[model samples]
Target chain A: GIQVEQSPPDLILQEGANSTLRCNFSDSVNNLQWFHQNPWGQLINLFYIPSGTKQNGRLSATTVATERYSLLYISSSQTTDSGVYFCAAADTGANSKLTFGKGITLSVRP
Target chain B: SQTIHQWPATLVQPVGSPLSLECTVEGTSNPNLYWYRQAAGRGLQLLFYSVGIGQISSEVPQNLSASRPQDRQFILSSKKLLLSDSGFYLCAWTQYGRGRTNEKLFFGSGTQLSVL
Candidate 1:
């Protein structure tokens, strides 16, 4: 089993501000992803970057596999972006089950 | 397009009652299915996973169980629900790969369960 830790357990930002969320894993992983859990409890996939960098609209993620860390960046934050962001990883040797971090709760104000 | 469906978006049941949640996937074959539970304001916990039909693996020892009776259908069941069973249950599926490199899960909307 792999352990995941997220930094800045809580974050607050004003509209148009930018924030970065980090995820650290206890071991190497073959898959890494960033997810946004909306207020309605729907988990939306943001990025599937086991390594390298990827961007989707105002969201982008980068995973450094060797260092066992990943980062999620939200730029020009909007009210709709207010939610819990989670990072999950799957170790190759494991049973292909995702180990999720506690999540970073984000709040955006108008 | 691939899509995952889960039923009874919300449920409320009395303690000790039997529980069953169903999840199905479309547009794919021989997909790997998973069941997860999330407590209020907590991270997701892996409950069970199935690599193929009739093959199930439990990640945690709990009151719940899971079965894959068909290729695209996975079911989570419990003989008797406990108060601790109250949580948001999510069903997800992904294509099988040689290793984790090809592992990427797509989750359903999830079911919120409340046990009294």
Candidate 2:
């Protein structure tokens, strides 16, 4: 089993600020993704980046597979961004199963 | 576009009661279905996964069990619920891929289960 750890377990930022969340995995991954769990307990997929970089609106993600780490960046954060951000990974031989990190709680104040 | 439906939105049951939560996916075929649980102030944990109909895999040993009777339908069941079973249960689906590759996981609204 692979281990996924997320840093800065708790984060508070004022609106219009920027933040970065990191996820480190213990083994090589074939799949990695970022998710946002809103206050209502809905999990939304943010990015599917096993490697390389991708930007979606004000959110972007980069995964360095060789380093076994990934980064999620939120730019000009808004009040709606207040929630838990999670990163999950599936090791190369794990098939489609993904092991999740503890998640980073982000509080964006308006 | 694919969509996942999980219900009921919230549930309350006494210990030793039976529990069943249903999840269905639409607009896709042969998709990978999964059940995940999130405890209070914790991350999501994979409970079960199904790659196809009648094919199921359990990630951890717990009081619950999962079944995939149909290609797009998944069900989580428990014969005798425990207080520890109380948590937020989420259902997700992803595009099926070969060779162990995986796509993004799209989740349902989730069910808040409270076992008293």
User: What is each candidate's DockQ, to 2 decimals?
Assistant: 0.62, 0.76
Q: What TM-score would you report for chain A in candidate 2?
A: 0.98
Model 2: per-residue Cα lDDT over A30-57, one tens digit each: 8999999999999999999999999999
Off by over 4 Å in 2: A94-96, B97-101
lDDT of 1 by residue, A1-110 (tens): 78999999999999999999999998888888889999999998888898999989999898999999999999999999999998998887755668899999999999
Error of 2 at A51 (Å): 0.7
Best by DockQ: 2
lDDT at residue B93 of model 1 (Cα atoms): 85
* DockQ score for candidate 2: 0.76
Error of 1 at B11 (Å): 0.5
Candidate 1 structure quality by residue, lDDT tens digits, B1-116: 89999998999999999999999999988888899999999999989988888888899999999999999999999999999999999999887622232567889999999999
Model 2: fnat (fraction of native contacts): 0.97
Supply the DockQ value of model 1. 0.62
lDDT of the candidates, in the order given: 0.91, 0.92
